[model samples]
Target: MKIISEKCKKCLVCIDACPVKAISKKGEEVTINGDICLECGCCASSCPNNAIEYE
Candidate 1:
């Protein structure tokens, strides 16, 4: 799944939840490349800050 940056707090919740380690930090933003995302909702649901969401 892809994430909406506006809703993201850069909390890193999605970063830790990704089993494939696809999440990454870019400056103050948490970014996930769709190519490596695997379409798993794990990161989205794990985000306590609601930083990640489905595309």
Candidate 2:
């Protein structure tokens, strides 16, 4: 999964939706921890800004 930074609104919605707690935030930036991520698309689905992508 990846975050499309240009589209991200920093809402933290993806962080709350991650089932494995793979998402993290630093300041206004959000990132997914690839090693811990399940790639379940939970965060992607929850993001209102469509910032998270699964590939």
Top candidate (lDDT): 2
Count of clashing residue pairs in every prediction: 0, 0
Go through the candidates in order and give each one's C-alpha lDDT.
Answer: 0.80, 0.92
Residue clash pairs of candidate 1: none
At residue 13, give the lDDT of candidate 1.
Answer: 72
Quote the RMSD, in angstroms, for model 1. 1.3
Tens digits of lDDT, candidate 2, 1-55: 9999999999899989988899999777898999999989999899999888877
- Which residue segments of model 2 deviate by more than 4 Å? none
The 10-residue segment with the lowest total lDDT in model 2? 24-33
Task: State residue 5's C-alpha deviation in candidate 2, in Å.
Answer: 0.4
Score candidate 2 by TM-score against the native: 0.92
| Predicted structure 1, TM vs. truth | 0.80
lDDT of 1: 0.80
Write candidate 1's Cα lDDT for 1-55 as tens digits. 7677788777787778899988999888778877777887899889876766677
